[model samples]
Target: MPNLRDHATLHFIVLIWGFTAILGKLITIPAVELVFYRTLIAAILLGFVLVQRRQPFRLSTGAGLKMLGTGMLISAHWILFFASANVSTVSVCLAGMATATLWTSILDPLINWRRIAPFEVFIGLVIIVGLYVVFRFEFDHAVGLVLALVSAMLAALFTVINGRLIKKHNHTVITFYEMAGACLGCILFFPFYVRYFFPKRGLVLVPDAAIDWVYIGILAMVCTVYAYTVAVKLMTKFSPFAINLTVNLEPVYGILLAFLIFGDAEKMTTGFYIGTLIILLAVLAYPYLNKYFEDTKNAWKDRRAEKRAEKQALEKQNTTNQDPALETIKVNR
Candidate 1:
């Protein structure tokens, strides 16, 4: 089990991740360019760490291509994630991203060709109600919320794909390749991005301000590289259940931090908060609900086994009680 310090460290890492949207808003660069630089720097940092640790850097061509494809999804996810923050308040963006669990619940069964868990579907519907409440009250930020929701869907897709890939490859190596792929994707898309999206400004690769560079650096290095590596290490000590349950709090932490930093700008309607609360409750309850179902199934199995044992024992007792005279006759024969 992880000690208190380990738990604290994990929360600190999550806090850094929570700060990511804030950092995205604080930086003056456009979302696409921001993702490009973030991935580029993070890839370089991770690659250096891999080389220093003498980790293998090569993969089969097929796996490399798969990682590259997945990288595109990651790139899209980050772009929309940051764009949401740019267009609306950080709380709104994070609130939408918080629905990622609901997306995963729907996608995982379909993608993996398994029966959908009914409880998961029930919770997912609850999340939808929450979203409706938010949308009804905060129609002005609809675009941002929609963008963030798309980002969450992309996140769920990539996560499911990564889950499959990690079974056969080193997690760190997979992350490095994915980051490299994301960076390459950003580079390839630059022309289209400039021609269509921002015809007036042209291509702006570097941050205009020095302080923006600082924020980007912290985003790439501390948030992506350091936190990712440390979280992987922590997996050896903590259960995945524990880690994921804690990660569900990222939106909560982010929203609170956004309020703290941006003050009145981060405030939202009562309906918005109610919606957020409902979504978070569903997200947080998932693991416990899953565990409960599993435990109940196991207990049912145990009870059946006990009944079978008792039935056999009683049958044997009945047979022995009637068999003494018959046994003597059979022995004599």
Candidate 2:
């Protein structure tokens, strides 16, 4: 079981992750360039930490390739995530990303080869309803919302993949390779990004302002390196469901922070808030509903077992009563 400290640590990690969007928006560079720098810096930092701790970075070729692919997914997730915020308000971006839990519920069963739980589907439907509400109110930001939703799906995918990888590798080692892979992935995409997306400005490899550098540094070091490393480590103690459930609170923290920092810019219509509340309620209520259903199932099983035992006892008693001669013979013997 996880201790209170473990839960607290996970929440702290989520808090850091929540700040990531604000940092992304603060930086002036395009989302792709920002991801490139973020990943490169994170890779360097994690590499230094590994060298200092004398941790080996060796892995099988197959695993290395897999990590690289996972890194590309992570890169896409970050690009879309930041792009959503750039195109729309932070609240809209976060509201769209908040659908991650629902995606996870759908994806986990398929990925793990488990039967889909009806209760999980019900919760997913509830979240969809909430998202619909947000969509209806914030129709102007539909494109950004769609991008963020896709980003959330990618986030859920990589998370499930990491759930498999962490069992066989150290969290730090995994992060080092993944970050390196993400950096390389970004580098490979640079040409296409420049050609198609920013043809007019060309490639933007550096931060435009000094404060942008500070924000990127915090994003790479504090958010990416520290928070991600700790989150991966905590996965050893916490189930993916529990971790993702807690992460549902990210939007709550982020939106509140955005409201405080960006003021009116982050505020949404009343319908958006209502929609967000519905989604949050479903996310928050999932664990309780799961536990209740599981407990009920277990209790029913226990009662059935007790009934079987009692029936067996009565049947034996009746058998003994019917066979008095045999019982008497045995007793005499």
Give lDDT: candidate 2, residue 103: 88
Show the lowest summed lDDT stretch of 10 residues, model 2: 239-248
For candidate 2, give the lDDT.
0.90
TM-score of each: 0.92, 0.86
Q: What pairs collide in candidate 1?
A: none
lDDT of 1 by residue, 60-117 (tens): 9999999988988999999999999999999999999999999898888878887877
Q: Which stretches of candidate 2 lie over 4 Å from their true place?
A: 1-10, 232-245, 295-333
Cα error of candidate 1 at position 118, Å: 1.0
lDDT of 2 by residue, 1-333 (tens): 899999999988998889999998889999998999999999999999999999999999999999988999999999999999999989889988988878888888889998877899999999999999999999998998999999999999998898899889987888788888888999999899889988899888777798998899899999988887788789889986698679779999999888988999888899999998998899888877877888898999999999999999999999988898887899999
Question: Which segments of model 1 are wrong by more than 4 Å?
Answer: 301-333
What TM-score number comes out for model 1? 0.92
